[model samples]
Target: MRQSQNGGKRVLIVGGAGYLGSILSRKLLSNGFKVKVLDVLMYGREPIEEMLAHDAFELVEGDMRNISTLVKAIERVDQVVNLAAIVGDPACTLKPADTIETNFLANRALAEACKYNQINRFVYASTCSVYGMMEGDEKLTEESSLNPVSLYARSKVQAEEGILSLEDENFSPTILRMSTLYGYSPRMRFDLVVNTMTKNAVIDKKIFVHGGGKQWRPLLNVEDAAEAYMRVLQEPLKNVKGQTFNVGSEEQNYQILDIAKAVKESVPNAKLIVEGEEKDLRNYFVSFSKIEKTLEFKAVKQLKDSIFRIKKAIEDNRFSNINDPKYYNVEIG
Candidate 1:
């Protein structure tokens, strides 16, 4: 294969058939990196079905928690990106044991395996929800104290700590505390705030705003999130190694009510409703300066753009059934 910007480096993405992983794997392969995906295919193979034919793409169907499977997958791979997890608040709550085992324990095991295999460069996918909630208008940074409110966030926090603890001179690990993601993916997710709102506006013709719609959330497109991973992997190790960066644009932060309004604006016939005064405890925005300055990474997709894109995809019948169990993590996971 002709060389691309990534210099044909082989990188293994654990759980690479999930929503974010599927997108990231495609991005890596398109940019000249040989991509090896290790996934149990919990959501099924359709997300990666088209890519199976790509010369640079290789799929290893196995569980990341199995030591033997992980060890074999890491062979001949230069770096590893861990994106394997139960992945959302409700989903994690439903399967607490699996969440802990996959998100936290499996992550630690993955780190140990990478270290043992001498794969020094590792990028771990973490979530900005680790901040939980912040007082006033404060925008939480990587240095801010964590107050994870959900089992999902807590598991990710524990995994981040566990992986970072394994960092040494020979093992370079970088943690990316990503903002809540939206936009369309092969493995679409309607569980997220933005996507849920957009789906509601498109299907139900109404968007519900709970907790007085005052909670703050930072949103990033699935594509932008994938780009951030590519940037980190392509950059010099000294710049990203042993570092934690929140991945999102400063301009993408929006109040819950405002997100509903944006979706309504995209689908003009949709009505917006406010339900209950009880706020969502997991309310926080994040700072992306660390990544912007260090890796020169900035999310290019706007919230309105994603809303419109999703709306168009829905209108185009890209998904025969928008209510599929596979589109929702809580439903299928």
Candidate 2:
């Protein structure tokens, strides 16, 4: 049985120093969990360096691909949240070999390790991009056929299958198919749609929309994404075991043009320019009803709120250099 929201519930958050992971680490620590972050910190250590002072926080700086590292990291862990990956389409394409090793093979090994170590809950972070380029107005559910067009999405699909195959009475794995994340994190990213658009509008004075910006995308606040993981961890094994939940509200889905307009609204003088064919093959809306129905998880942050929040962050210079390679997964990968 799970600890049921008690203190001293130790968690190993793989890639916990990355964008979304950084946000989650802070949350878990605040909630009284002994948070262990196993990350290469590929970007840098500054994102989570402050947490080093917290008694409840521990940072295991190592590669997830290393079995010895996994063995050490999972020690005394009650839950495992796998958030490490190549992250986006371009990053996977840029480093195909690395993507395969990290996203698929390494994840499979991690899930197996969790099972071996008797870790009660293993939550895997997946993407809504797995529902790539669906037809019509259908909001893709967990049961919907996946049409992954990019190597990134393909790796997640393969990894999800691999992780789920290990689920049994001892090991419970819950998959979260997260929407495209926005808003700010301690370890920030401007590569995502809202962040990118808001950054461009503020810094570049212009916003670029590709393929006329008509693709449907579900957006989730980075903070809300963190909350979903917390909720899943608190729930009993029987409720979330071997389950996959889409983690964004249905109303949060929007066309790219709508995203651009929001950025324009936030950044007063920004000009919007549409260009090119939809070079990116990803276009799909997701349904969050399953998570809402099962765990009462509904994303509270709105798209406009994310846009303005990012805009405010930039104006305050909370993050520096919009073109910094650190902000871009593909460039850094």
Give a tens-digit lDDT track for model 1, residues 82-136. 8888887888888999999999998999998898778999999999889997877
Q: How accurate locally is residue 309 in candidate 2, as Cα lDDT from 0 to 100?
A: 84
Writing each residue's lDDT as its tens digit, candidate 2 over 245-265 gives 999989989899998988898
Clashes of 2: 0
TM-score result, candidate 2: 0.96
Global lDDT of model 1: 0.89
Record all residue pairs in model 1 with backbone atoms less than 3 Å apart, i.e. clashing: none
Candidate 1 structure, TM-score to reference? 0.96
Question: In candidate 1, residue 54 scores what lDDT?
Answer: 94
Q: Local distance difference test, per candidate?
A: 0.89, 0.90
TM-scores of all models?
0.96, 0.96
Counting only residues 3 or more apart in sequence or on different chains, how many pairs clash (N, Cα, C under 3 Å) in candidate 1?
A: 0
Cα shift from native, residue 232, model 2 (Å): 0.2
Per-residue error (Å), model 1, residue 135: 2.0
